[model samples]
Target: MQYISAERYGNSYRNAEKKRYRDRSRAELVETVAETVFTFCAFCSVLAVASITLYMVVNGTPAVFRVGLKDILFSSTWKPVAKEPSFGIFYVVLSSIAGTAMAVILGVPVALLTAVFLAEVAPKKLAATVGAAVELLAGIPSVIYGMIGMMVLNPVMYRLEQRIFARTPGHQFTGGANLLSAALVLAVMIMPTVISISETAIRAVPAHLRASSYALGASRVQTIFRVVLPAAKPGIATAVVLGVGRALGEAMAVSLVSGGSVNVPLPFRSVRFLTTALVSEMGYAGGLHRQVLFTVGLVLFVFIMLINLSLNRILKERERQDD
Candidate 1:
C-alpha cells in the first residue's frame, strides 16, 4: 500500500469515529425525547382523573355534611325552594336505579341476539350493512334521541296509556311522560354500544375453539352458547357495565321523557332520576341547593364506582373458574 501521511490518516480516522458517535447520539436523543413525550401524555391522563376526583370530593362533601347524609340519601321528600327546604333524594336515586335496570332488561337480550347474528348467522354483506347501521345509531346525538322520543314515542306512549288506564279510577296520565318512557329511550340509546361490543367480543373468539367444539360433535348453537359466549363473558360484561354507566348518567334524554317529577319509581308514574334532578335545577339554584347538586353528583359517582368494583370482581371470579 502507498504510504500515507500520519496526520492525515489520524484526522480521517477521528472524523469517521466522530460521525458514528454523532449518529448514535442523535438516535439516543430522539429515543429519549419520544419516551419523555409518551410519559407526559400518560401523566396528563392520570392528572386529569385525579383532579376531577379531588374537585368533586372537595365540592361535594361539604354539602353532604351540611344536609345530613341520612336525610339526603334515605328521606323521600325533596323541597329545595320551600321556606324550610328538605334535601332528600331517595326517589331520585331509586328512579335512576330502576330506569337503568329496566333499560338493561329490555336492551340486553335484543343486543345479544343482534350480536350473535352479526357474528355467526347473518351473511357477510348483510352483517356489514347492519354493522354500519349500528355505528350510525351510535353516532346519533343523545339530544336528537330525546327530541325524537318527545315527538314520536311520547305520543305512542300517550295512546297506550290512554287505552290501559282509561277505565282505571284516579290514574292520571301525564301524556306518557313517565319512568317507562325514559327507560324505553334509554334502552334504544344503549343498544348500539352493547351490540357493537358484544359482536366484537364474539368474533374475537379463537377459530380453533369452535373447531374443537365441532370436532367433539357439538351442534353449532351449542358451540356458540357453551364455548364462544362463555369465552367472551368478560367483554360482554364490560359492554353491560358501559351500558349501565350510560343509562345512569343520561340526563337530557331521560329528563325529557321522565316527566321531571320526583316520585317513587313506578313505570307508569312521572319520575326523576339523579342525573335529571341535578340538571333540572342547577341553573336557578343558589347556595345550599347548588352544593347539594354537587352532592348528587358525588352520590352518582359512588354508585358508578360500586358498579365497576362489583362487575370487576365478578369478571375476576369468572376468569378464575375458567382457568
Candidate 2:
C-alpha cells in the first residue's frame, strides 16, 4: 500500500520543476529578442536620418562657398544661359515661401473643419465615407496631381487671368500656370494630410473629458472647441508641420502649375520655386550650376528642419502649460 517509489516521486517532481524553469526562461528569451529587434529598428531610423543630413552637408557646403552666399540667397538675377551667367535665387525662395504660406492659409481652416466634422459631428456612415475619400486623396501620387493641374486647372486659371486683365488692354496672359494655380494645387495636396491626422487626434481625446465638460453645462460645440481641440493640439500641430513640409517639398505639382518662370510671387504671376528650380535645371546642369543645386537642396533641408524644430518647441511649451 505504501509504495513510495523514488523513480516516480523524486525524479518526476524534479523533472516537472525543470520543465517549468525551461518554459519561464523561453518566455524571457522571446521578450528579450523582441526588445532587441525594436531597439535595432529605432537605431536604423536614427542612422538613416543622420546619414542623409551628413551627405547633404558634405555635398552642399562647397557649393555655398563657390557661389558667394549673398548671391545664392539674395540676388534676384538667375540667368545661367546668358553670356555672363548669374545664379541668384531670391525670386525662387520667395515663390516657395509664398506658395507654401498661401497653401497653409487656404487649406488649414478647411482641413480643421472637415476633421472636426468627421470626429465630432458627422453620422457614422458619412464619417466613414468621408474618411475613406480623404485616405484615397492622400494616396494619390504627386505626379497625378501635377498632370491634373496641367490639363484641367491651368485652363481654368488662364480664363480667369484673361477676364481679370481683359479691360487692362494687352496684359500678357498666363496660361493658367501661375503662383495662384500652384498655391491652389498645393492647398489641395496638403488638405488630406492635415484632415486625416487632425481627425485622429480629435478622436483620441478621452470620452470622459467630453462627458465632464457636458456635466459642467457645456454644449457640444463649446466642449469640442474648449476641451477637445486643446487636447488635440499636439497632433494637429504635427499635421500642420507635415502639411507644410509636403507643400514646401512638392516640385512636380508646383512646377507643372507654376509656369516654371522666375518672377515675383504674385497670385496670378508666373513663378518658380526652389524645388522647381532644382528639378527643372538638374537634368542638364553641370559644374557650378550642378553644385549650386546641391546648395539649394541644403537650403530646403534647413528650412524643413527649422520648421520641425519650431513646431516641436511650441508643442513642448504648450504641453508645459497644460501640465
Off by over 4 Å in 2: 1-41, 208-219, 318-322
How many residue-pair clashes does candidate 1 contain? 0
TM-score of 2: 0.84
Which lDDT tens digits does candidate 1 get at residues 266-293?
Answer: 8888998999988889989999999999
Where does candidate 1 stray beyond 4 Å? 1-8, 207-219, 314-323
lDDT over C-alpha atoms for residue 95 of model 1: 95
Lowest summed lDDT across 10 adjacent residues in model 1 is found at 1-10
Question: Per-prediction count of colliding residue pairs?
Answer: 0, 0
Tell me the deviation in Å of residue 129 in model 2.
Answer: 0.8
